[model samples]
Target chain A: MELLEYGFMQRALLASLMVGLVAPAVGVFLVQRRLSLLGDGLGHVALTGVGVGVLTSSAPVGTALVAAVLGAVLIELVRARGRTSGDVALAVLFYGGIAGGVVLLSLAPRGQATNLDAYLFGAITTTTAADVAVFAVISGVVLAVVWLLGRRLYAVSDDEEYARAVGLPVLPLNIVLAALVASTVVLSMRVVGLLLISALMILPSAVAQLVGRSFRSTLYLACGVGVVVSVAGTAGSYYTGTPSGGTIVLLAIALFLVVTAGVALRDATARRRHGRQVEVHAAHPHEHGEGCGHRPVPHGDHVDYDHDGHLHAPHRTGTGTHYDEHDGSAHPPAAVVPPVGRERP
Target chain B: MTDPAIRLAGATIGYGDVAIVRDADLTVRRGEAVAVLGSNGSGKTTLSRGLLGLATVLGGTVEVLGAPVGRLRERGRVGYVPQRHTVSGAMPATVREVVGVGRLPRLGLFGRPGARDRAAVAEAVEAVGLADRLADPVAALSGGQQRRVLVARALAAEPELLVMDEPTAGVDAASQAALADVLARVSAAGTTLLVVTHETGPLAGVLTRAVVVDSGRLTYDGPLAGAGTAGPDCHHPDEAARPPVRGYRLDQPRPAPDAVRLRHGSR
Candidate 1:
């Protein structure tokens, strides 16, 4: 409560909370598209925007938003083209952006008040009331779009080809999603910093996937995680003289590890309980172990050996090590894909 | 009000510059259960994609349910189940959510799913026999069940012509039987069916006629029993004498993307 007595702290807190809410709300779709690095890419380009603002005596945030959106559009255009050289295009844009930013920032007048580190590593304490107002508008727009078109966006992100076949305006929705990411990147620039924006967007959503039962629940859980970490990380940064971005990301990663451990523990106990119900153990002359000439399949907390095209799990009883033949049905079909080279028909 | 479910005249379907299906000609009356058979590297899937307006229409005209593919405003009326669809294992989407997207086109972009939409989704899920697993994540489903989910997704659209590309591919027999059972119900309910598959297997009983696409041509079109004679590798020696299919390329004078968008704007 004492932190709110300061105008700057209140601004930082408000901005951080908006970034917290908006980052993961848009991020779930980005991660779904396998574009987790997009936030980072936009963050890199936003630096160029910052440099342009400083050199030309304009608002850094506005320039950053424009630049980030341009980068987003480029990424979307490449993606829509569906070519193999896309990675090269992305690398060029991101690297070229950073180099350009450094050059531009260096050219700024000698008496420029802003430090590059503030943008790179988030000086949450330096947030102005005006910046907070802008953050409020951007975050409000992002959240409204997500609310209105949640299912449509999910459909397009989850399965683009299917969505298009079903007539969902795949290209337009893609552009909208790109714009959302761009706005989100700029919105998050001050709280989590440009470099660490993706972490804020991705990490919470990643953790939510581990425990969420459905898409809606996962989205809600991701937003909840986002808020908890942002607010706590902001408060924690105030207490300790640490960068807000690092503190928030570290807290997010710690939460990720903790939730991962809990899920693994729960799965292990469930597997054990399930194991107790089954009594049959396959008798085989060749015992399966490390370096066994069999395909190792990951089966939740334990590795299942693919024995003669069948999955085998090693069971340890009071007797000794025995390989229990797990049903072939347990394996994902992608693992046992029928012969390759067959045309899609 | 009355048009064949599908009508293709010398259509050559392909992607980009390469043509896969060449000079395909076929027509199916309303309510007909037709299976398009072909082998690997054959143009069957490409032909399917071309007719669905997903791929480039290299040549000729394709009409589905009385309208051109892209001009068909109600895209939900043409349900499609893609081949070996994994349903995006990267994210956590429940069966309901996955199937729910199938209704989006019919519901319009801005409109939310109403009770009727929800009922349609539930009905579609139940049709595929995944009613109990509606709330469960699609990632947890086995490959066979995922295939069923894809079918349910298409069925949710309530399309007049339900085209399923290789539904039995990579699927176990039990699931194929389940799929066939659902198709039987859908067919009985008067929705046309266009199935593309390498292995007919359990679906053989459901298909009344077979149209085999070999080397991008309709080698045979008749009863299901004769499909094996003109199997994927079976190409006639005189096929070379046939005229080439007219092709349209990007460099060619094709309709611009903006024009296409303008047409789709009303949709």
Candidate 2:
């Protein structure tokens, strides 16, 4: 409890909470649209922004926000200009951004060097007041946009063509979605690092989807799951002497697996019960020996050929039998027939 | 009528160097409902796009509402519902938001939607009988409902001409019927309609005229009944003055087996 009273711990907690709220909120749309890779690409671009800020002696988060917006705009432009698949485009942008960041870092003046490892894989313990404030502002703005346009976003995400035909400015809306994703990625980097940010963004939303019945429910549940994982992972790291960022991501993954397993188990149990009900109500007439007693013996005792060359047993009443022209019939033994009065038995 | 709503003289349409449709002379009267019918890849879409200024008119001239189609603004005067493929289903937007986009050209740069725009959107939604679904996510709606929303978006613009490309493709029978009924009502309300479609089932009685294109040429342009069984050139308006190509027929048999097979397969 004394450790929680410290300013750094509070700042880390606040930043993680903000990220946990914002990333999954944006990620619900991203995951539904199968644009999960876009989150990853934008996070990598945020790294380049960090490198640029470090080289120019500017604020890293501020620079990263601007860089992310620009990167998002470029991505939209590239997507509009080319016919390539979004994944392919994202791959190109990801590698290009990473290479650009490395070059920018190398070019920075020697005396103005900044730590790059912390940005690459986050150090939650090092979060400052400014970082917390920035996270709050970004998360608030993102939340506002999402709340205002949630229904529109849902429609577009489900069926872009239908949305456009109905008069939704699909192109502009897509750009906005991408922009939101980019902003969330940059802000989340403070808590989860550029490399592992998307896991925090996507995993919780995916887990929420397992238990959610609707789009709105999924988003709400995802935020809840995200907050829980972030707080638990942060505290566990503080007490257990583990890396906070990696621990949070692993925790989110574990939650996702558990949720998925629960859903699967419930579905399996329901299906088994349904199968039993269906079996009880179904009638079987061929179990009794009322008909098909005088048919010729089949070549195989378990199998017989029908007239159309299809196979069936002669003694099966409900199952029609057929005979092939190439096979000569042999008479069946009298012992195969049951006594006349024992039909039900 | 002051002037024909649309006129195309010797227009050639194609992508890059290959011409899919060429040397077409056509005119559409005000408030007319013209249905362009053709098999797959028969250049119906290209011709429709040309009228909307989406496709380049490689030669001759094209005009809309008495002005060159190139100069005609793309907003309220000429509303276009592109083929369903042009839009993505994975897009996130509500029916109202989708309808609201139809007002973009009218809104101008930096202009936001006002109460009037909202009213128009509402009216349009109501016109298509989708008022209850105005707040629904477009993906949750059935295919027929989605298509109705598209029509409502076009109606929001209150255009004099509404152009739809394959509006009923992949829709069920009821949806297709509902779409046709909506189109008929819109036409009755005085909007000229240019419908590009292969299946002419519901539009059979309502269409004012039918035009057929084949191999980059206008094969027939007349009343729907005058379209002969199968031919390369079959025109009406006179019997003796018909061109020699009018009687020239392809050897292909009527009611092609493949077409029959597909029809039965669909059922």
Candidate 3:
């Protein structure tokens, strides 16, 4: 209640909420495509934009958005040409942007022009009401785009080659994806800064993926993680006098580690229980190559290999399919239709 | 009669200026189960990609379902099963979720899947005999099962034309038979099937015709029985001692990498 009374604190919280919610939606797509580092690369490019805006006395957000979008298009073009691998092109762009940013910042006049440290690590509590409005607008656009293209994006990220074969406009979709990612990275600078923006984008999805069962569930859970971490980390930073962005990212990493450990423990226990069940059921444990010489033991649609030499009944698992381990034969024959009567026969 | 389900005449498929398969002419009538057989880098996959608009049609015309390959927009009418290895390694999607994606083109950019999409997904999973494992994560499935999931995803689209690349490449013998069974049902349903595989194996039972590609050229296009095994022109021609047809083993140790680099284009 006390923190909410202050105008700056209210603005910071809203900014945190906006970035926290949108980043993971974009992050899930990136993670599924195994391009998680693209966020980080784009963040570096945004740094150059910030530098240019600082030197020109223009709004940093607009400059950063433009630069990042241009950088993303360049990256996509390089990838399309196939001359160099994607990572190689991204690396070149990332380092070049950062280097250009550093050179520009060093050349600018020192006092009151721009606080480079603020853009690097963020100053969440310093966000003004105008910044909150911008965050809201940007977040609104990101969410709408994602909502409309979510399924198609999932298909592309799941398998680009297949999506293309299905005639899903892979290149344009990819470009749109890059543009959205660029927008999110630019908007998130207020919450987590350029350096730590990718933390917001990637960590929640990684954690949610470890525990969530399905894609939709993983996406919702990731948003939940992002929101929870942002609130707790922002409040903790206020109380502890720490940098808000760094604290939030650290909290995310901690949550990720905790979830990972919990998943590992749960898997271990399940493995132990499974082992016990196998031991109880084993009259004979057939090794990989040591075929049972008998029919497969069907256990409710699953073929269980028993340690006992007793031959298991050859019951149909589904649609009269049975497997004999000795010769690797499946019943009902592999073909669905009657065998084609070849003219030669 | 309706036009062929797919036709590519004098099509040169490649990435840029370099053509992989030169002047490949292929046609598949409705209700036919055809396999485009070739060794690795022999341009069989490229040919399929060309038909699906994945590859650049350097020359000649490529059409699908009475539409140009590049302009055809009815995605639900054509289903594709890419190599299984690319489908599962990255995402954490479940078998049901992945299969549900098959319904996306039908759903459009903003459309949602209602009862019809769900039913299609269920039917596909059942057809592949993976109904019990619908909720299982795709990563948890074995390589063979993963391949089946890909097939189910394509089937969920209810496509009239199904194109699959190496459906049984790394699958075990039993799973291969099961896949064959599923493909048979798809073919029996009157869907045109284009299966690209190196060895006929279990598919030999159902494939009505075989179109062989050697060095980016159509070597044979005839009934499955008449198409002889991989010969001197097939992959690894250096290993002439290797038996052709049923004896060709995909799991065999690789020859030199350069030996299979006949096509210098997108995979």
Query: Against the true structure, whose DockQ is highest?
Result: 3
Residue A307 shift from truth in candidate 3, angstroms? 10
lDDT for B184 in candidate 3 is 89
Tell me the spans in candidate 1 whose CA falls farther than 4 Å from its real position.
A280-345, B72-74, B233-267
Residues A1-345 of candidate 2: C-alpha lDDT, one tens digit per residue = 966898888888888888888888999888877777788888888878888898889888888888888888888778766455765777777888888787888888989756677787788888888878788888999998898666566656755543443345567778888889988988888677888888988898888766553466678888998998988888788888787789999999988888777767766664465346435424433331235443433232123434333223333224342221223343221112221211110
Local distance difference test, per candidate? 0.80, 0.69, 0.77
User: Better model by TM-score, 2 or 3?
Assistant: 3
For model 1, state the Cα shift of residue A224 in Å: 0.3
Ranking by TM-score: 3, 1, 2
For candidate 3, please provide the TM-score of chain A on its own: 0.83
Instruction: Mark the 10 consecutive residues where model 3 chain B has the least summed lDDT.
Output: B251-260
Q: Which is superior by lDDT, 2 or 3?
A: 3
Model 3 residue A79 CA deviation (Å) reads 1.9
TM-scores of the candidates are: 0.84, 0.68, 0.85
Descending-lDDT candidate ranking: 1, 3, 2
Tens digits of per-residue lDDT, candidate 3, A1-345, equal: 899898889899888988889999899999988889888889899989988988888888889999999998898788767754776778889999888887787777777456778888888987888888888898999999998898888888878877877877787788888888999998888888889989998999989988776788889999999988887889889999999999999999999999888777766665465346445435444332236454445432235443245323232334443322212232211222212110000
Q: State the fnat of model 3.
A: 0.46
lDDT at B147 for candidate 1?
84
Q: What is the TM-score of chain B alone in each candidate?
A: 0.85, 0.81, 0.86
Interface RMSD, every prediction, one decimal place: 7.4, 18.7, 10.2
Give per-candidate clash totals: 0, 29, 6
